[model samples]
Target: MATTSDPNQKTPLEIREIQELAIAISAKNINPTMLSQEFLKQTGIVPNEWELGKQPVLGPNLSQVTFQNGVSIVAQPRNITFMESIGTKNPSELNIPNIARQYVDKLSNAEYQGLSISPKSLIPFPGSENGARNYITRTLLSPGPWQDYGKAPVQAGLNLLYQLDRCQFSLSINEAKIQMPDQSSIPALLFAGNFNYNVGSNSPQEILEQLKKGIDDWSSDLKDFQEIVNQRFLAQQQESLFPGA
Candidate 1:
């Protein structure tokens, strides 16, 4: 028997823009209070001329700093994360990876566990507020009688994990709303990718080398993510929204 495609079916969502990129390192005995602006300058982790975007948060267990260039550093007891808003800048221009490598090099005494490089983006669906929700419930998932049990429409999200040769990759898709500058909000899908690498060595030098290698391979991982999202998940589009991929 021949199966016919539904004519009323809507188009699958495509990635609209790259929203944020981040590098997070997990370690032991990390003192977040030590991440001061003066300490960052003294250690050469950040340029001396760079001004802070806001007042630095220095606490016993957590610390945070935002630079004027849209780079933000957040440190907790178990991990430290460096994030930057992609905006219109090319991903190649990002320096957070270099900064993270420098930090690990300088703080060689800390016991590093693993690191993850993540890229987050917004996938906008055309027409209607329920586009993303419908994509998840009706498209990605199998239809069953369970969907009719809910009073409101089903809200769903997906998380997939894949073990690659060099790293463990995970992609999460969720329904989200983005607020515009005019105070209006629109429905969208958020595609988040994480490439997690484990540093197996206890030696600081070995850990630093491992982390540097992960950072170096981040661009390729990002490209892989782009291919997966664009070719496999979303509409059949060959063009990439992310620059330098």
Candidate 2:
């Protein structure tokens, strides 16, 4: 099976699924031990009826709670992370960003440093593992002797960072093994994106407002990442791969 280089190809890619979406907030004064089911219910960060998937961990340095809805909130001494497995759901319906904003709103007195919104996806190569390897060496990178230095075929990964108008964006691409429901696994490429936003205000209230704005822009950022991968990178017309552009 040959991979299509036409960006406008009517056929969809083999597999494109969002694995996870996360929002991590950096704070200096948060106590992880304060996180608990009772605390969440009392602060109204989560609904009272929400049940935990497992027993909550209320340790001195780390606290975590996994909800039945696939949302997990983990709190460390200096950072709090809200994450969810998106599976096949639309990104617009994700609730982790809103929940992170709400948590910050409730704990308005913590000293916040910054926040990052991240999403990861898995896309399998159309053919075999060699086809995926060629994408990095032949398509992305120019042919050179550096690729042939090793005894075996070189396994490569790519990481890129860009400064956008609103935040710093980072993208990482690497090969991953995706486990199937039938106890099998297949090789795939993992695309991870992080949008880092810095709070420029000193007041906690102002910081909260800034975070809310960043959260609101998450959907657009996600779309930008998808476009970069599907349109710019994977969609380039390669004469060698297609045999006639």
Candidate 3:
């Protein structure tokens, strides 16, 4: 994923290119002491260790330009390991070639990280509601971007697109809330790391574990209360979507 200089944009980027950037900024790598030292060296602000919330940032930057068709983008990742399968859905059906699998993993992880943070994975499982919530908050939400959703449109700077069918996604900005027809369709965002870094050398599993530890420590009692409210809201949403289950 090499980058080319474009004179028009503030950054060197292409107009319609889809790129994924993954980095391992784990807790062990970026602790309060390290972050404070770096911030002090750069900005001289001596940032309060608590202000950062000590979250572990993982995965790649999922940045993309407009789709080929002008109004839509289809997300059919080739290879990924889901927590649970979506019925009989198969990754091969997505039609992404073997050479493109690296892209698939990068993009999928990005989507997973984004969705897990805001409100995607907040819903409780049928039998183990608390267990499900805690797992997500600890494993995924804790180390991932739990607080990214509110600032997604701005900080992430990716337009919200609706998933009309399967991997099909369409751009819709008429309303404040973005909709998705398929849960797997991930929107785009800026890549936060250097693209020239070695691609085949990333230790994915170890990096993920490191991130999880960071988030687990950074989380607080307030996050748990928010999860409760989110759970209730999700339950209500389910009831509205399906009257009787």
Candidate 4:
């Protein structure tokens, strides 16, 4: 399928039956550094100072921003699953019509709630960059609405699993016990806005940051992780290859 270059396209080709939830609120009293420190403390990892200078401070004027994400959960077709399994030594079969409908219904409800808010009326992030800096620092959506922090949309799938209530959609993850239910479910997070959400040009530092954030998930499958990194950097490489294209 040909991907649409039009930014205004209602739905992108890769996304199917996507349901989004957007929440805009004042980001006051939310220090991303403090949050990061807390997260590091909890994770038992030392916070690395990259000499990134000061992460931009959000003043009162631009403090109000949307905290939003979209989800696309669909039942894998038999043929698609088979195609996906072609080279595998052991391919597992799927139980169709299992929880697909239930998830879809939940996404529909999320979309309904998301649409109630008017993003246009709210103030946009000031400056050239359309995405908010604080959100990127905190990684509200791990694996990304921001890829600079080293999280892929796929890893974000795991992150979303934790956010969602199991009662609505049966899913769980336990690292200590090494337990993960619903292996078939693939999840991603997307940002919706009138303006672009890209954070300037890709830099080595940002890429390094992204690598650090994704290192844990990277170990299981380096090939898959490399693909995501390649996709993230492709646009920049293209722009450099054909400047002023």
Candidate No. with top lDDT: 1
List per-prediction Cα lDDT, in the order shown: 0.77, 0.76, 0.25, 0.22
Determine the C-alpha RMSD for candidate 2 after optimal superposition of all C-alphas. 6.1
Q: Which ranges in model 4 have alpha carbons more than 4 Å from their true place?
A: 1-130, 138-158, 163-245
lDDT of 1 by residue, 62-101 (tens): 8999998878999999799999877667778987877888
RMSD of every prediction? 8.1, 6.1, 20.9, 24.0
Ordered by TM-score, highest first, the candidates read 1, 2, 3, 4
Stretches of candidate 1 above 4 Å error? 1-15, 237-245
Clashing residue pairs in candidate 4, if any? 143-151, 150-210
Per-residue lDDT for 80-178 in model 3, tens only?
A: 211111112242332112212322333324322211111111121222313323333443334456444674321212234333221222221111111
Name the better of 1 and 3 by lDDT.
1
The residue-by-residue lDDT of candidate 2 on 176-208, one tens digit each, is 655544444445667789999989455777887
| lDDT tens digits, residue span 164-240, model 4 | 12111112111111111322221222222211112114354553333223222222232322233235422334332
Give the clashing pairs for model 2.
Answer: none
Model 2's TM-score against the true structure: 0.84
Report the C-alpha displacement of residue 193, candidate 3, in angstroms: 20
Off by over 4 Å in 2: 1-16, 236-245
lDDT, residue 214, model 2: 86
